[model samples]
Target: MVVANDEGGVKPSHGGPAVADAAPQVDHGMLALTLGALGVVYGDIGTSPIYAFREALVASSGGNVAEREDILGVLSLIIWALTIIVTIKYILFVLRADNKGEGGTLSLMALARGAFAHRPRWILLLGMLGASLFYGDAVITPAISVLSAVEGLNVVTPTFEPYVVPLTLVILAAVFAVQRFGTASVASVFGPVTALWFLSIGASGVVHIVDDPEILLAINPVYIVYFLANSPEVAFVTIGAIFLAVTGAEALYADLGHFGRRPIVLAWLAIVFPCLLLNYVGQGAFVLSHGGIVGHPFFEMNEGWALLPMVALATAATVIASQAVISGAFSLTRQAVQLNLLPRLEILHTSETQSGQIYMPRVNMLLGIVVFMLVIGFQESTNLAAAYGISVTGNMLMTTLLLAVVMLKIWKWPLVAVVALTSMFAVIDIGFFVSNIVKVLDGGWASLAIAFTMALIISTWMRGSRYLFEKTRKNEMPLGFLTEQLAKKKPQLVPGTAVFLTGDPLSAPTALLHSLKHYKVLHEQNVILSVVTAQQPKVPDQERARIEKLNDLFMRVTVTFGYMEQPNIPRALAICRKQGWKFDIMTTSFFLSRRSLKASPTSGMPLWQDKLFIALAKSASDATEYFQIPTGRVVEIGTQVAI
Candidate 1:
């Protein structure tokens, strides 16, 4: 996993560190993490019963409630979709593609890119695209989940209809507002509450299943084939809506790192899957018996007194779902920033003990605004449903493709086996993807638009960075050259140490060169420091830093960090003392280089992209603060670069 940086002595860990130690904090017993999974991983899909069935029914049959075949067909589609897509693809396969036991679009992409040894351009594009789609999914999941849950109020009383949108907005607003305060306290109970919610809905559906024990025939694939054959028009539209049943399925894989693979799989198979099947079949039975009950089939399944309680519990479950997605967005933003896909913003760690618990104010604020506007724009859960699933499907499609590369190239699987396994998943994914695409004009485009905009920005930043690196490398002076020049000139030797940050350790950092040139002095001790973020989730403490002494006065130190860990220069510097390198907080002065970027048509990128990159760089998180170096002891040297 360790790849040496010849220039700055930076060593990148491609394979990541030992995972046994990577997840210690989260390595709770299976039962505990399962409870955690039930609370977080399954929240999105768990809340789907709130509107998925009713929406599909309305989309398929409309007022033709007497059509038993349509109901059974929709049921079959839902069942198979959950089995094929959620169970087989994500839970069984994609979950296995963890990056040092972490899963997500970016994580998968990093794994795939690393497997190639050399970064292939297409993998980066796919990763960026998938990551972008997730942001869109993040915004939509909260809006739709909350709106659908609050819409339950309309069933309690027709008088509550007008207030549904406003209530949803207020609830969602409250959800986003509390993010800054952290969810450590509230997150614990989410599992028990969600588990209860699943059981309640399952029981409600089971009670109604007695109305039509014949609905059990839906477990037969023949019914699905027969229904699709008899009613093609209804089946097509129904398939699109049926996708809603597994809307939050991606959360299982996206959150694999939090609860690990086994607990999430256990939670789904033991609790989530069965509950979903019972409730879905129960909804089907209820629809057939009541001739499609009015005002949300899910809420209608509950008898008189149960309606209010059901609504309240449903609201709570949806809130949990929204919370998970919002937190996911925050996590995704941090990943993007660290990977240099996005500009670095302020990152606030919310939990004292859990390294994963982080909050980004800019991401939260932006997500809140978009989700609020989406709620107001869509107006109803049913309407918002049209916008859901596109991004999820897109992300899945990309993940499937990336998984193929991992299986064939990374895992050394036979090409035939890789193609066969990936193709099976691809067929289902492409179906769902196309189904969601039909909804583009109906609101799906909203997510696509957001994704496209993000892809534009991510690609721009990445491309601009590649050009910047190439340009910087082209003009670099060799490390030996700088050292020899210092020795020959015999510059005034200062008392304290100077740590200069550079991306390439072999070259002289512009800041170091500038400092030496201007002051005609060199520190008693000098460090060519390069900070690296590995492709893996968590790098062990033992492998955090690598120090190489090139000569008596100079040392090249490459500090390695896993993507999941934070970067702190002072703390990392302290690690070197154990190995005979004296690191004094008071005596060390950090030097940073700031590039004054100028856009040129003939430079690294188009003028517009160059300008955007410059703006992002200018607004990035402060080097002193980001590195956790003392502000008073840090110095920044500027160098102009044409890009």
Candidate 2:
């Protein structure tokens, strides 16, 4: 989809010119991006097999009857579930929804908002809210993925079983602790490890398949029908379990900008999807053969030495999955800041070359604390799993609704085709949504809490923007009118360069206004440098920076990079120096205004919430130094405004 920046002059850079077109070269190998995307993208979906089949068996009562029919039925349902849900729907279809080669709720939202910016107000609000819920999903992902992985030990050792909560806590603590170092340090191992992990799952399934060859019949549609026909209630609850397998399917799209959509789709279709199915089949086979072991049959599948390796492998896989979610949270935060929904926090790029692999310390630390508390509160992965599916399902529901709009309103597809296609996906999503509702009282509230928090943030940003628009004088000082005034007043003032750094380029720059009001001078060479952070994993140096001349004298140059990237303004200034640009850093001072927000009764929002949001903004946002501005020649301007 074509995505336009809110700032009118800047063009969308899907496969076009990017802002950082002049930066130094850094080559993060295709393998590194692939593995990093794999590590981050596959977390929740990777660990789904741990509970998906087991929960389904428990719901079906097929666990107590280990007959050939039961095995066939369970295997069929699982195989078809993987095929229809993960493979066909998400990997094959929905991954195509890209906003200038970027995918995710935010990218999709940006695309939608930009397209319908001039349309009705409801469309904008709904799209923004949907994107905001993704933040909540990011928080809940790691907590549940690691928790479920640690729970596997219960089947191996009874003593170890009770320590699942503490162990998950420790694992999460370690996961969050390592974020400051960035994934570049461990990028080499993720690919081979996750590849081996999938192989092991396939191997485990092969062993079970050898015992009962007839279990292969479970791949047929008959078993799914039989299970559903027998007990609709059981099938309904199993929807929650089945949805787990496809929980992180959207990550295939969300992380598409990092690895590109092709590689991710290839990885999911080839290595990830097949192995997940094999494991589910294996689990189903074990359940069929030993029906009465419903309570914990996953661990009961093997005996002696085999049990230990399986347990160890599952733990490692779980940790890997959790690591992915943590990294995703960092990416989401960067996206939020770029879209202006959240404050700019310090973002550190671990690798100089690979822009996609980033490390944000604040997000890491906050997620660490939350995941640790979650592990202790839930005490077991299964319990945590109850909270896991809700956020993803909610996101999918939003996607389903929005895709309908995209097809009908945006794409202008035939109404019949749109309804037919969207209705099918909606039904599948609603099944998962209803199933997750059963978990609402069983630790499912955590994701909801996080979603509400993010919703508040997004809502506040929108409200604040509206307030600023309403209160500001429209004709008080126009840039075009002021430029005409400057041209007539001082014809000789147009010789040197004046660079103004701004938060939003389309909006009137406070720095520019201050200069016009105080100095009464305008440079012949004016540079409006806008720095935009991309949400993807890495944007190439060629894609990071850009320069455009606005009628010779007024130039608007923007520097765009990933959040995981470093800001080198001095080095950039040096590049400008090579171009014969003249500016004395000491004499040509930098300007930063401190916005003092006051809560007025005028804004149609809850006063308490507005005050809380303002406080949160003040406390949570990083200082100006975080954006890498020079301190010596900088001038601070504080302005008060009522909200």
TM-score of 2: 0.84
Displacement of the residue 327 alpha carbon in candidate 1, Å: 1.4
Note the Cα lDDT for every prediction shown.
0.83, 0.66
Candidate 1's error at 390, in angstroms? Answer: 0.8
Model 1 lDDT at residue 40: 89
lDDT of 1 by residue, 1-643 (tens): 3322212122323355677756455545778889989998889999998888888888777654637877887898899989988888888888999999888888998899888867787987888899999988899998999888888887788899999998888998899999998878788899999999989988898898999998999988888899778878767777778888888877887898888899999999998999999999998998888865534788887859999999999899999999998888887777776676776677889999877788888789989999988988889877888788789888888999999999987889999999999989888888878877898899988988889989988877667766777788789899988787666667789799999888877788888878977988889999998888888877777788889987777899988777666778788879888888979989988888877778878775777878887877676677677767789998888788888
Using TM-score as the measure, the top candidate is: 1
RMSD of each: 5.0, 6.7
Model 1 vs truth, CA RMSD: 5.0
Best by lDDT: 1
lDDT (Cα, tens digit) per residue for candidate 2, span 1-643: 1111221111222355776767855555654666655666775677777766666665556344444554466567667767877777777666776766777766666555555545444654565666656666666677776676677677667788767777777777787788788787886677777777777777777777665555667778888788777768867776676676677777777777777776787677677877877777777666656543565555567667887887777777777777776677777666666655665567778887776678877777777777777767776666777777787888887777766776776677899998998888888878888888787888778877877777877677656654544454342355555555555565446444566665445444566777767777777677666666554424566565567654555666666655334455545554554455554665555555566678888767788966965675575443445555577656666667676
